[model samples]
Target: MFEALARFAVRFRWLIVVAWVAGVAGAVVGLPSLSSVIQTNNAQFLSASAPSRQAADLAAPFQGASPAATAIIVASRTDGPLTAADDAAFSRVLLAAATITDVTSVRDQGTSADGQAHRALIVTVPNGPGNAPNARLVTAVRDTFAAASAPAGLTFHLTGPLAQTADADTASTQTGDNIRKFTLLFVIVLLFVVYRSLLAPLVTLIPPVLALLLAGPVIGQAGQAGLPVSPAIQQLLVVLLLGAGTDYGLFLVFRMREEIRRGRQPREALIAAMGRVGESITFSAITVIAALACLAAASFGLYRGLGPGLAIALAVMLLAALTLLPALLAIAGRALFWPTRPAAGQQSIGMWGRIAAGAIRRPIPVLVAGVLLFGGLTAGLNGFTTSGFTSSSPATASDSAAGSAVVAIHFPSPTSNGEILLFRFADPVWHNPDALQQAHQRLLTAAPVSALTGPLNPNGTTITAADITRLYASLGPTGSLPPTPPAGITPSLYQTYRATAQFISPDGRTARFDAIPAAGPAGSRAAIDAIPTLRTTVADIATAVAATDSGVAGVDATAYDIYTTSTNDLARLIPIVLLVIAILLAVLLRSLIAPIYLIVTVGLSYLAALGFASIVFVHHGHSDGLNFIIPILLFIFAMALGEDYNILLMARVREEAHRYPLHEALTRAVARTGGTITAAGLILAGTFTVLAIAGNNTQAHQLGYTVAFAVVLDTFFVRTLLVPASAVLLGRYNWWPSTLSRTRTTDTPPTSPQHGPPSPPHARRARL
Candidate 1:
C-alpha cells in the first residue's frame, strides 16, 4: 500500500508540493488569534470542584467591587531616615496614583520601621496580566512613583502579585522564543553533522518546519475555541512536532538511502523504503497520539487541554511524514544524499551494527547485563522528588529584580507569597463580636500567622456593636468616610475603620484576610504540604464557630492542587497508555507475547531514563529535582517512542521469520534496521536537548534534558540490545501461539548483501 503511494508521489511530486503550499496558506489565513483566549491565570483553569475554585465562586459577588489587580509600591531613601520632604513627595505620589485611569484606590500602609522606606498598595479595577488596562496601570504606577520629587538618593520600586505576573508573562514569552530559536539552530547543526551532506540536512529540515507551520495554527485555534491550553502546553506542542516529525523524516530517508546504496533505481528505492518503514512510522505516530490522548482522563484542566492539543499537532506531523515527506523524498531522489555515496555492494557496519551482532550472539548475557544496568539506574527512583511548579526567576534581572529586593527589605510580609482566606458569615462579623472572636481563634489553630489583616477590630481578637456604631458614625453613616471624624472619635480610629471596610462586603456577610504562613513561599513543598492540614483545621474551626463558609485561596492552595492533580494523572494515565499501546502492538505484530516483552523493555527504558535524569539534576547538577510533570510526560513519550523502534525492528524480524529460523530472523532484522532506528532516536533526542537553552526556565530545562537522555536509552540500549536480546532468548516462543513459531528450525542460507528487494541478509562476521 505504501509502495503504491510512494510511486504516485514520485510521479506527482510537484502536485504534492503545491498542495502543501496551499494547505499552509490556508492555515495561516484561517488561524484564529489566540491572544484573546490565552489565559495566564492558572487559578482560572482549575476544576470547578477544587477548593480554590469553589472559594472563588463564593467570593465573586462580594469581590465584584474589588480591584482586579493590586500593586505594592515601596519608596526607599539612600540617606539614613525619610525626611519631611520625602514624606510629602510620597503623599503626592499617592495622590497621582489615585488620579490614574482605572485606579480604584491607593492607601499608604505606613513607613518601614527603619524609616528609610514607606509602602503603599495601589488598587485598580478591570486589570489583569495581559490586558491593556493592567499594563497601563502598572506602568503608570511605576512612572508616577519615579516622578515623585523626593530628596536625593530616594528610589521607587513596584512589586506585588500584579507586577510579578506581568513580569512572568514577559519572561515566559522571551524564553519560549529563545527555545525555538535554539532548537532550530540545533536541528540544522546536528543534522549537518550526522548526515555529513548539506543537501541531506536541508531535506531533513523541511518536514518538521512544515509540521510546525501546519500544526501551530490549528492548535492555537483549538485554544481559542476554549480548549484549555496553557503556556507550558503550547511550548511542548512545538517541541513535540519538531522532534517527532524530524525523527520520522530521518527514518524514511535513511532507509531509502540504504536501498539506493544497494543499487536499486531511485524510484524503486523510494517505493521499497516506504513499503519497508512506512508501517513503523504510522504505528509510531499512532502510539504517540494515543499516549498523549490519555491525558484527557486527567481531572486537571491543564492536562485535559494539553492532551488533545498535543495529539492534534502530532497527527498533523504524522500526516505530513506520510504524505508531504514522501513526496519530498520522491522529488529529491538520490540527490537528497548527494556528495555522500556508498560503494556498490559495500555495507557500513557502524556502532549500532557491532552492538546488534554482540547482543544477537550473547543473548542471555546481554539481556541480563542490560536489565541489571537499568535496574541499578532505576534505584535512583527511590530518591526522586517532584520539583513543584515555582519561579526562581527574579523578575527581569535588573529593574524588576531590584524592585523586588527593595520590597523584600522594607515589606517582607508581601514577599512571603502566603495564603489568603475568604470567610463568609451569616451576619457581618464586625456586628457580632462572638462570631468574630471565634473565627480569629479558629485561624489561630494554623498558628504562626506572621501577619493577619481583616475586618475585625484592633488586637484582631474582637468586634463589638459599639465599634460598629462608632465605625458608621465616624464614616458619616455612609460607606464613605467623612473628611473629619465625628465628635469624640480619634483620626487614627477612623482611618483604621475605613481601611477595615475594604475587607468586608457591603451586604455584611463576607470578609477576606491576608495571612503569612511561617513555612515559606507558597511554591515551597512545605507550604503546599501544609495545605491539607491547614484547610482541614480551618474548616473544622469554621464549622465549630458557625461561620457560614470558609475556604483557602492563594498560590499555596493552587500549588497543592496542581501537585495532587498531577499525581492523580500519573497514576491514572500510565496504566491506560500501557494497556492501549500493548493492544496496538499486539495487533500490529499479530502476536500476543511479543507485545508484552516489548512493553516491559519500554518501561525499563523510561525508568532508566528517569534514574539518569535524577542523578544528573539532583545529585550532580544541583537542581531541586525533576519537574513535577516530568515523570508522566517522560513516561508517555519514552514508552510510545521507544516502542517506535521496537515495532520497526520486530515487524521486520517477524517478516524474516516467515522465511528463516527465529534466531536468524532476529540477526537479519537488527542488521537491516539498526542505522535508521538509531538515527531517528538521535534526531529526536537532540531536538529536546535544545530546550535547555530556555534561560531560567527550569521546567523546560528539566523536560529537555530528561526526554533527550531517555530517548538515547530508547534508541541505543533498549531498541538495539535489550529488545533483540530478549527476543533471541525467547526464540520460537517470541511469537507464542502463532503458527510460524511451530513451523521452522532449519538452517537457511541468508541472501547476500546486494542491490535487491527487502529480504533478510546472512549473519555477517562481527565488525567488533
Candidate 2:
C-alpha cells in the first residue's frame, strides 16, 4: 500500500505538490481567524454541570452589582499612617478618577482597620468579558492617580481582574511570536547538525511550515462547527504540528538518503524509503491521533475541544508527511544533501546500535535496570500537587502584578481575590434581623474565612426593629432616604440599611455575602482548597436559615471547579486513552503481547518524564507544583510520542524477523532505524524546548518543558534500550497469533550489499 502511494507521489510529483499547495492555500484563505473564535474566559471552558457553572447560573440574575471591569487602586503610606494632608490628596485622586471616560462609578472602600497603613478605591468601567479592562480606561485611571498630590509616605498601586486579563493577554500574544521564531531557529540548527547540509535542513523544514499554514483554517472550521477552541489550544496547534511534522519528515527523508547510499536511483530510493518507513509513520500518526481523540470523552469543555483539535492537527501533519514531503524529496534528489557528499559505508548508527546490542546480549539486566530507573522517576509523583486553574504571579512586568503586591501588603484582606457566597430562602428573611445574624455567623466562622461581609448592617452594632422600620420608611421606595434622619433613627443605622440593599433581591428572599481567604493568592492551592469548606458551611447555614438553595461562587470556587473537572477528566480519560492505544497497537502489530509491553514501556517513560519535570521545575525552578494541566498533557504527549518511536522500531523488527532470527532481526532493525528515530527525537525535543523557553504563559512553559524532557527520556532510554531488549527476550512471540510468528524462514540466505535490491515478492511478503 505504501509502495503504491509512494509511486503515485513520485510519478506525478508536480501534480501532487500542486494539489497540496492548492489545498493548503484554499484552506488558509477560506478559514476565519482562530483568535476571533477562541475562548479566553475560564468559565466558558467549564462543563455545564460543573459546580461552579451551577453556582454561576444561580447567581446570574443577581450579578449586576459587580461591574464587568474594575480597576482596584490600593494606596499605602510608605513610612507611617496617612496624615491629614495625604487624605486630602487621596480625595482629589478619587475625584479625578471619576471624570475619566468610561468610568461608571468610583467608591472609596475606606482605610485599613489599622488606619496607619492602607486606603483603597474601587473604580468601575464598561469592559468586555474575561474582565478585560478597556485600555483607554486603564491608562486614564493610572494617569489620574499619578497627577494627584500626596504626602511623602503615600504610595499607590493599580491592580485587579481587569489589569490581570490585559497583562496575561499581552504575554500570551508576545510569547506566540517568540515560540515561532525559536522553533524555526532550533529546527534549522538541529537539522544542519544532523544532516550536515544546507539544502537538507531547508527541505526538511517545508512540511512543518506547510502543516502550520494549513492548521489555521482547519481549527477555524472546527470552531465554526461549534467546537470550543481556547486560546491555549490554538497556540498549541502550531507547536504540535511543527514538532510532529518534523519527526515524520525526518523518518522518511533519512530512510530515502540511506536507500540512495545503497545505490538506488533517487525515484526508486524515495519509493523504497516510503515503502519501508511509511508503516512506522502511518502507525505513529494513528497512535497520536487515537490518544488525542480520547480527549473527546473529557468532561471538561476545555479538554473536549483539545482532543479533537490536536487530532486534526496530527492528521494534517500525517497527510503532509506522506504526500507533500515525498514530492519535495523526489524533486530535490541527491542535491538535498548537497555541499556534503558522504563516503561509502560511513553510515553511523552510533550509541543506539551499541545500546541495542547490549540489550540483546543481556536482556534481563537491561529490562530490570530500565524498570528500576522508571520506578525511581515515578517516585516524584508523591510530590505532585494540583494547582487547579489558579493564575500565577504575572509573568510579564506589568502594573497589575505590581499593584497586587501593594494590595496584598496593605489591604485588610490577605489576598486581592475575593469569594462570594449566595443564598436564597423559601421564606423572606432579609427583613428578619435574627436570620441575617445567623447567616453572617455561619460564613464568618467558615474555615479559611479571614474576613466576611454580610447582607445586613455591615458594622457590628445594634439596631431595633422600630429603628429599622423608620429608616426604611424614611428611605422610601426609590432606595433613597431623606437627607435628614428621622427623629428616632440614627444616621449610621440608616446608612447601613441603605448599603445592604444591593445584597438582597427586591423580593427579599435571597442574599449574598463576600468572603476573603485567610491566605494565598486567588488561584493558589490554599484559596482553592478553602472552597469545599466554605461550601459545606454555607450549605449548612442555608439549611439553618430555611433557604431553598445555596452555593459558593467566586474566583476560588471557579478555581476549585477547574481543578475538580481536570482531575475527573484525567481519571476518566487516561484508561480510555491507554485502551485506545493498546487496541490500535494490537491491530497494527498483529500481536497482543507486543502491544501490552509497548504500552507498559510507554507508561514508564511517561512517569519518568513527569518525575524529571518535577525535579527540574519544582525542586530546581522552585515552582509551587507542576501546572494542573501538565500531568494529563504529559501522559498524552509522552505516551503517544513514545509509541511513535516504538511503532517505528517494532514494525521494522516485525518485518526483519520474518527473514532473520529474532535476535539478529532485533539488532539489525535497531541499527537500520536508529539514526532516523534519533534524528526525529532530537528535532521534536528541540522544538518543544524552544516552546518551553519562549512560551509566555505559565502553563505553556510548563507543558513545553515537561514534554521536551519526556520525549528525550523516551527516545534515549525506553526506545533505545528497554524495548529492543524486551523484544529480543520475547523472540517469535513478539508476533504471536500472526502469520509472521508462525511462518518459516525461506531457504534463501539473507541478502548481501552486493546482492542488489530483493525481488518485490520477497519485500512484500516480509512486510506481511
In model 1, where do residues sit more than 4 Å from their true spots?
Answer: 33-38, 58-159, 342-344, 348-350, 390-407, 412-416, 445-451, 456-469, 476-494, 518-521, 619-625, 737-739, 745-768
TM-score of each: 0.87, 0.84
List the candidate 2 regions with Cα displacement exceeding 4 Å. Answer: 15-29, 61-163, 342-351, 392-396, 402-415, 426-430, 446-448, 456-472, 476-509, 517-527, 619-622, 744-768
What does candidate 2's lDDT look like per residue over 302-332, in tens digits?
Answer: 7888878889888888988888888888899
Alpha-carbon deviation at 599 in model 1, angstroms: 1.0
Tens-digit per-residue lDDT, 1-768, candidate 1: 988878888888889889988998898788853332344555655687888767665555434333236667778886687777877888888889889998777766555545667667776674432333455567778888667876777887777655665566666666767767877887788778778786877777787787777776787778766687666665676678778887887778877877777678777887998998888889989988998899889887777887788898889888888888888877877777768874346564445545666787788898889889999998877768786454334456745566767756654353235576777788765566576666665565566354665555321334444576556544543234433456877645554565455456556676666677666655667777788877776678778777878888777777777778788889988889999999899888877889999999989989988998888888888776688878888998888888888888888888777766665676667777887777777777877877755645677788888888888988888888888788877777777777766765623333432223343345322210
Global lDDT of each candidate: 0.72, 0.73
